[model samples]
Target: MIKAVFFDFYYTLCVWGQSLEPRLRKITERYGFEVDPERYVKARENLYAEASGSDPTTHSLLGTMQEIIGSYCEFIKGLGVQEHVEQIAWELLQSEHSLFAASAATLYDDAIPTLEHLRDAGFKLAIVSNWDTPLDPLTERLGIAHYFDIIVASHDERVKSAKPDPHIFNYTLAKVGVSAEAVVHVGDTYEADIVGARNAGIRSIKIDREG
Candidate 1:
């Protein structure tokens, strides 16, 4: 019998669209500067492309934000928006709370009820997320933090490796004090969740939100 269930955070337990706009606005406000949201979007997209690759460097949201903001400042100068760049940086620095707000991402209607049912049925709960930001506050915001017996965020040095690496899955199972055969994982990423769980000798369920 499966005694425990592990879950992935983004796309599995949550969903969002255009998540960066709020922070972009906050930055603009702080700097007393303005730019077409579309331009900022382009800059952000460029930054994402620059930071992304197969080098296997574990990713962090906070670090990415810093890089993206810096890139945007330089790009804005090219676009003649240099005066407003510091405002953007200042806003980003002050808007950690607002950025955290994006973490909600509208949990699936079935997610909570399913979690409650499983918990009541004696299933141990844990979260194994590949996020650069601290997840404890976001879990508290979701009100389901208590449901989890353990929460592991990639930001924690203990999880030096990111998804697609079985280290995290193995570590989580170890923490829950369960054997791989007695645990199951649920996540949205085929490579990360499915492959990682399989590598760790655990069964996995992939949630396809589009389906």
Candidate 2:
């Protein structure tokens, strides 16, 4: 018997808005640089997979000095901001996220319905995601924050490790006051959510939007 239900954020609950690149370009321009939207979008296209946050440690990697300075070096060069390459690269790197719901994402058509179903069924709801930002603000922005008893992101201070690391799942289980045997997680990533929840003694449902 499931007492609680946890969900992943990206792809599971919402996906990036279609204007992602243009919005990114707009942010870059605001940084005092003239970025060709075409070039900027192209640059981002090349980094899409790496930016997906699929790997357990991808969140940590994005903050590393090497990943920061190196990942967007090509983007900066392509946008003709080589003069401020390092600085601009840092800015763009940061732009990969921030206020996910307000600026960059929209919920799937069924997300609210599913959450509502779980909540109405008397299941405690939560969000357990391998994300860098706090999940509360995003969930709150999407109007689904009220459905969750707790929302945990990898960056949440209470989470000692990201997904695919059982630590986070265990921590969340503790927070929700449920045994792993009585809770289940739903997410889009296999290695991160499924594997992590499994390692934590919880079951999971994987959402494969691509297929």
Name the best candidate (by TM-score).
2
**Which runs of model 1 end up more than 4 angstroms from their true locations?**
17-62, 66-104
Which of the numbered candidates is closest to the native, going by highest lDDT?
2
Residue 46, model 2, lDDT: 59
Scanning candidate 1 in windows of ten residues, the lowest lDDT window is 48-57
Listed per model in order, the count of residue pairs whose N, CA or C atoms clash below 3 Å is 1, 0
Candidate 2 ranges with C-alpha deviation above 4 Å:
19-96, 99-102
Summarize candidate 1's per-residue lDDT along 93-201 as a digit string, tens digits: 4443235446435667788998999999999999987676677887788788999999987668777766667887888888999999999999876667787789889
Ten-residue stretch with the least lDDT total in model 2:
48-57
Candidate 1 residue pairs that clash: 31-87
Residue 121 in model 2: shift from native, Å?
Answer: 0.7
Please give the lDDT score at residue 159 for candidate 2: 69
Clashing pairs in 2: none
Q: For candidate 2, lDDT tens digit of each residue in 1-211?
A: 8899888887688876633455556666766766676776566545543443333344454454465466567656766675767766665545444531347667888999998998998999888876665668777888999999888877766565777888888888889999999998998766777877899999999887544
Task: Estimate the lDDT of model 2.
Answer: 0.72
